[model samples]
Structures are given as C-alpha cells and as structure tokens.
Target: MQNFFPAQYSTLSAAALKDYLIKVYQLDPSTTCRLLIRNVSDTYILENQTQKYIFKIYRDAHRKCDEIEAELELLNILKAEGNSVSYPITDVAGKQIQQFNAIEGIRNGVLFSFAEGKVILDLDSAHLTQLGRDIAKLHQTTSSLKLNNPRPVFSFETTLFEPLKDLKPHFSEMIEEYEYLSNIADKVVKKFEEFDTSKFNYGYCHYDFFPKNFHFDEAGKITFFDFDFAGQGYLINDLMSFLNHYFFHQLNNLISREQAEKDFNTFINAYQQVRPLTDDELKAIPYLGITFHIFFLKFFYDNYDDWSNAFLTPRYTKHRVTLIKKWEEMYCNF
Candidate 1:
C-alpha cells in the first residue's frame, strides 16, 4: 500500500522532497532512506557517508505563521540556558526557516538534527525526576527570550462553550453525541474562573508535552521535540497536561491517584528547585487539571466525526466523559 500524508498536505511530492534535500544539503537523492508522514507534517531522512539529517515539510503554512522560527529561537534560548534540545538545520539562505509556494498553497519547511534516544512513557522515577528538572531549566531560561508568536486562539471556555452556544439549534444532536459534556464543561470553567490565573505564571511552554514529544537517552537524560503548539500559557497548565497524557490517558494502567499525585509533586518539586512557585500557583494546580480535562473533552466532542482527523483515538470520547465524572466526584468531596 502507498503511504502519503492526507489530501490536505499531499502537495509534498516525492520529486519535490528529493529536490529539496539535494539542494539544501547537497546529498544524493539515491541515499534517501525513507520518508514518513506525521499528522500535519512530512519528514524525510537522508544518509551520506558519515552523517544523516531529518527534513520536516510543514503543511498549512497559511495558518502556521513563522512557527519554525519561533521553535528555533526557543531552542537556541534553551540551549544557552543549559537545557538539552534538538537544533534546527539552516537553509541555503543561512536561515533556520524557509518559505516555499506549492500548488496546494504556501508551504513552510525546516530541518533539524535528529533528536537522540527513545521516548519512554513508562519511565522510572529517576527519569521522571530528570524530566521535571529539565523542564524547570527550560521554563526558567525561556522566561527572558521574547518570542514572536501569540498563543493559540482557542482554549477551554472559548473552544467548548462558544461552539456549544453557536450549535444550540442542534442541541439534541450535540447532546446525543457528547452526553452532557457541555454542562460538565461549564462547571469546569466555573471552577477555574473562581481561581486566580495571575497566581499561575505564564510563559513559553511545550503545550503538547507527551512522551512522544520527548527523548530519553541511555544516561537517563531527556530532550524535547515538537514545539508546534509551544507558546505562552500558565506553567502548571502544561505540566498537568503532560501528566494527563502520560500517567492518565496513554498508560491506562492501574495508576493510583496517590501515585499520580506523587509523580506530579516530583516534577513540580524539580521545577521549583530552579524557579519557585507562589501560593496561588499551588492553589491553581487542581483546578487547572480539571480545566485542561474539559478543554480536551470539548476538543474531542467537536471533532467527533472522522476520528482520524484528530491525534486522539475513538475511545478518547469515553475517556473524556470518565475524566469529567472523576472531576465531579473529586470536586464534590472537596
């Protein structure tokens, strides 16, 4: 079977990918080992006598802005601050980011030195602790690098309720599929609103900090990748989102709430070693967890049809409902 990116980004032709590689790095196209499609991006690998490089072709440039620039800038900032990260490869123009026009639309692209090691989800305490320390270092240093992009336009309240309000005419249909997610989302939003966002510090964060976006070397060191969704946000927001993805959703093992809480504290403690958190930030953690849960719930609900369009699986709908119920049970007890 032939493998290619979805129709939306099929503009990346094989010949074009080959040409881009040869022109950029002077590598022989015959040495092209493989090309793979990742969600909205296409990646190609080329091998010469002694070196290899990964070229990433980005789709949807119209909406992407100069995100590669932001990512490279962020990486440089983190590296200067002593955080390990993948470095972006420069183009013939001596720039990290390059713009190209394809038949489908304008496509922006960049290359990167391949990040090392494997992404381990079921990591041990030592690795998790290292992840925490590394992330803390990143957050601490990135606070000063003024970035060029804005936060993504959507969030828990705006992405969920705003759409529900507009879709009121089809309340029955929406409710049928989501099963009271809107009402639960409202409660989640209310709980978050009651808390002070000011208490939680905001800065550039790897919004999608899943294990897949991380690397664990043999020495137990961690390096992060995919700053596609990176931007300014509450610090704990990304931390909890990482927890939800690794400990909660992805593993689905018998992770006791107590154990999960311990892991969260470990990461937070390591982060605080370099930069301390305020009383308000501590208070905001629990509510922010609930808010992020509802945020993804609405995300799943809106894209209910054609599950492949999303990074989540079809079971994500059920997982979201369960998370909401868990939050409700915990909230009432509190």
Candidate 2:
C-alpha cells in the first residue's frame, strides 16, 4: 500500500478564526464560535446576535474540493425545491466553499445555516414515518439534478468485495473468519450480478442517513443535515443503510428491536407512498443491506486490531454469518 495523507481534524481556535469570519462572512467582530465536536471533522457553532450558523473545517486531504462542492450543490437543489434542508451559504465573494491555511495544515471550510430544532435521539413510530417520508422527498427532488463533479459510487464490489481483498494482509488472529467473510461477500456479488441497477433507480443520495444525522421540530417537520456522505448511488442503498444500522443498534440493545419487523414495514411503506420502489429493488434490499456488515467488518479489522474485544469473538463471527443469513431470509420474505 502507498502512503497517503492522514486526517488532521483538530479543533478550530477562536483566536485564529476571527479574521476570516470578519473579513469574508461580514460577521460582527464580537461573534463567538464554539467548538462542538472534533470527531472526523472540526465542527463549530457560530452565533452573532440572533443569527446562528455552522462552520466546518474539513479534514485535510480527506475530501476533494469538487466533491464537497457537489454535495453543496445537492443542498441548494433540495432547498430550491422547498425540501426544508439546511443549505450552504456563500461568502461576500460568492464562494460557496473555501479552503484556507489553518494551524494544522491547509483545509477546506464551508458555512451552513444551522439546522434548527433539538435532535431527538429516541424515535417513535410517528418520527420514523415522517423520517421515511422526508428521505423519499429528497430522492424525488434530486433525481434529475446534475453535478459537474460527484462523489464515489458504492456497490457490493466497492463496499464489500474489494475491501476484503485489500485487508487480507492485515488479518492477524481472525484470518479464518476473514476468509469466511470473503466467501460470503463473493456469494453476495455472484447472486446479485444478474440484476440491472441503472434503470432510473440510481441517483445522488445521502449515503449516511443514520438516526443522529437528522432533526425534528415541534410542528412535526423533519430537517436533515450533514451531506458529507452524499453521493450518486442506488436509491435503495440509502434506505438499506438506514435499516441496517437501525438493526445493529437493536442487536446491541441500544433500542427496541421488538418492533423491528413492524417498524421496518412502516418505514418502507411510507417511502413507497412518495416514490414507489420497484419489486426488484425490494427484493434486493436484504442483499444490499448486507454490504454494511461486510464493510464494517473490514473497517473494524483493519483500522483497529481490537476488533476481537470490541465485536464478536472468532466463534461468534461464524455465528454472525448464520444470524445474517437467517435475517436476510426473514427480510426477503417480509
């Protein structure tokens, strides 16, 4: 493997950021920026008088400018269609995204209108239904939107098939389990190779629609933010990612999976009411959802040698394979 730039996602210091915000964004000199979270990217909350905004400094060398701009374009399209998204705002020079020299290194920066309302961590049926409807609306809105530069596309091969191969050399204690995952990934590829995925079902989608990425208001409106993972891919991919992660949370007792089947139906039916998912896409959901487990398995194994302590034991890895097969069967029959 070749060497590449590692993430330099240190927090933004208030002193170093004042000049840029004042000169470019025309904010008051007394504006205060608070570091919200330094994970993956440095995110800050900027407040001056009654105005509130989000300032994000992208991790150096992690994402390209054009790709970030494409995501920004997606926000504009959704907002123009009255979809209630927190869109990106431009500075005085009409620049939607800016790159500046930071104390760590050169990094990309963009400002956004703060998505209002408090985040609801524990979701009920009503919230889930509205969430489903909201995502379907986004899929419908950006179906035909064009972008000069787009992010990478994902597939069984990209998400699962190739990652296993690349991580083969990294396996230490779980080499056998890694081999089993490789075979499972291969079977997934061969089984689903016959379908045509490009039949108007592919478009730009929020690749990460996990629970915490959206917020709800008292008036029962849903506003989704965080388009860092937005890209062109199968529309169903978004739905599957949501469902798979929801199930993962359930598996760990983070939430109630007792209503898993019923809730799953509600979300899918709500989505279909807005934008009908074809029979083929419906059949493919289980297979597509398996991609997440495969991707994360490789991620946990490669990045952290502590996967054994954190996740299933080697014996349970095979157990997980069995559990996944049974779950897929139930999902396909659902």
Candidate 3:
C-alpha cells in the first residue's frame, strides 16, 4: 500500500481578508473581495466602489521576492513604452511587491491594474496578425532592457532533465516507451548544449504565450496577464509554446491542422514585420519543438491526476509518443 496525501491549502476568513487588504495594501475598506481561481496561485477579484483590481497570492515557496520583482520590473518597462499590459499597482506605501504571513503560511501578494477586454474565441486573420505584431513588440522591448533580479532560466534542466527524472519512475512498468522517451530527452539536451544560442536573440519571455493568458478588445488591443511562467529564455520558446498548444488542439480535432498551419504562418509573418527571425532562429525552431514536446510530456505528469479520467492512461503514453513522432515527422525533417 502507498501513502497518498492531498495538499492542504490555508484559508482566511472574509473579514480577515478585507482587513488585511485595507490595512496592509491600504485599499478602500468597503471594497468587496471575491475568489477567482485557486490553481497555481490564489487569485481574487478586488472590486472597489468604482474600479477593479487583480489580487494574486503566490503559493507558499512557489516564488521568491526577486522573481516577483523581476516580473514587475518587466511590466513597468512594458507600461513605460506605452505597451498595453496589466501593470502592477503600487500600494499606499509606494511598494508594488508586498509579502506577509496570511492564510497560507507565508504568501507573496501583488496587485495589478485590471485589464479590460475578453478572450478572443473567433481568431480572424486580422486578430491573429495583430497578435503576432504585439508579440514581436514585446520581444523587441524586453531584448534591450536588463533585469537586475534574475528570472529563472527555462533551459534543458528545468524542462527536460528534472521532468524525466520524476516521470521515468511513474511509468517504469512500460520499459520500451520509457526508454525511448529517455533517449529522445537525452538528444534534446545534447542539442541544447551544442547549439550556440547567442546567434539567435534571447531575452525575458513569457513561456506560456497562449490565447487564454491575455485579453483582446474589439480594436485588436491586447492586455496580457499571468507572468507566473515568465522567465529569461530563448524568444522562440514563447512562439513554440503557442504553436504547441494550437497543435495539441488540432490533434484533439478541436481545430483542423490546416487552420493551425494558417495561424502559425500568420503569426510568424506578422512577427517578422517588427522583429524578424533570422535563418538560424528558423532552423532552431524544430529542435525547440522537440523541447516543446518534452515540456508537454512533463505536463501530463504534473496534471495526470486532473485528466486521468479523460485521457491520462495507457493512452497518455501513446498520445505523447504520437506527438513526438508527429513533431519529428513534421518539423525535424524540415
């Protein structure tokens, strides 16, 4: 028998939460607080008499002071450049980063200006093109600004090495599949080591650049949030992350592969307008696509419990393998 323990989350009373907000952050006492989502972090909707704000409480030990500050610094840069983003709000004390002991043992809290607009369901050519342009602008700006606080590097170790370490044990019974994946992961790591990434532009990037992470109003304006996965890494990783998600949806039959291909072309073409990808960066995309596959494999391990009923089973292994094979066939050859 194995011992399985569910994670326990600390809670705060409504009164206590309101008091903390008013006293610590100096918000209006009459403000109404409501829970939003409690997945990676505990997010809340903070509504005052006139305005709204996003209250994010980092999970215990999930992030440190420097990492949060790094994100805020990047946001400040984006805001200063007249880029539309969910800028972090300064408290009454003029401090944006606030950490204090709360329902969670020790949580880091940040307040962000509420972003207006809604998720785009219908992706028109113009919408997709504008998105690509905005992404290019983001990359161009961040490429020049230097961050004093270190953002975690999204490299082979975090995405592949650590993930394979945790996963090999879970699926050890399937010797052939496990070993095959192990070899593929090893090759990806070797590629990372051999490639001179300096040839391609690299900078602070949102590793989770997907549609759900931002908002698009009618005028094609974008207000992005959720810097939880933001880190210093190759810019291509961001593009591939979006592509991987779209490709996964395509595989699931939610969208046609042709549509996915069109989106990819549209995004890349628009991106080229502001900051073009070099021939070297384009060549590196396939290898990075393999890295994307490795990232996807690790997601199944982390979220298996959440999707076990729907897909994470023996089918999960086959699904991962199929994705790897599919990427290899589609990209590696090109």
TM-score of every model versus the real structure: 0.79, 0.84, 0.85
Clashes of each: 0, 0, 0
Residue-level lDDT tens digits of model 2 in 255-313: 66567767777888988889998777877777776676666555555434322244445
lDDT minimum window of 10 residues, candidate 1:
303-312
Give the clashing pairs for model 3: none
What is the lDDT for 163 in model 1? Answer: 56
Q: Which candidate is the best by lDDT?
A: 3
lDDT of 1 by residue, 157-229 (tens): 4546665564454344445545566665566566666666665667787767888888898888787877766
Q: Is candidate 1 or candidate 2 better by lDDT?
A: 2
lDDT by residue (161-199, candidate 3, tens digit) is 777788777676777777777787777666656567678
**Which stretches in model 2 have alpha-carbon errors above 4 Å?**
1-10, 194-200, 254-258, 296-334
Q: What C-alpha lDDT do the candidate models reach, one value each? A: 0.65, 0.74, 0.76
RMSD of each: 4.7, 4.9, 4.4
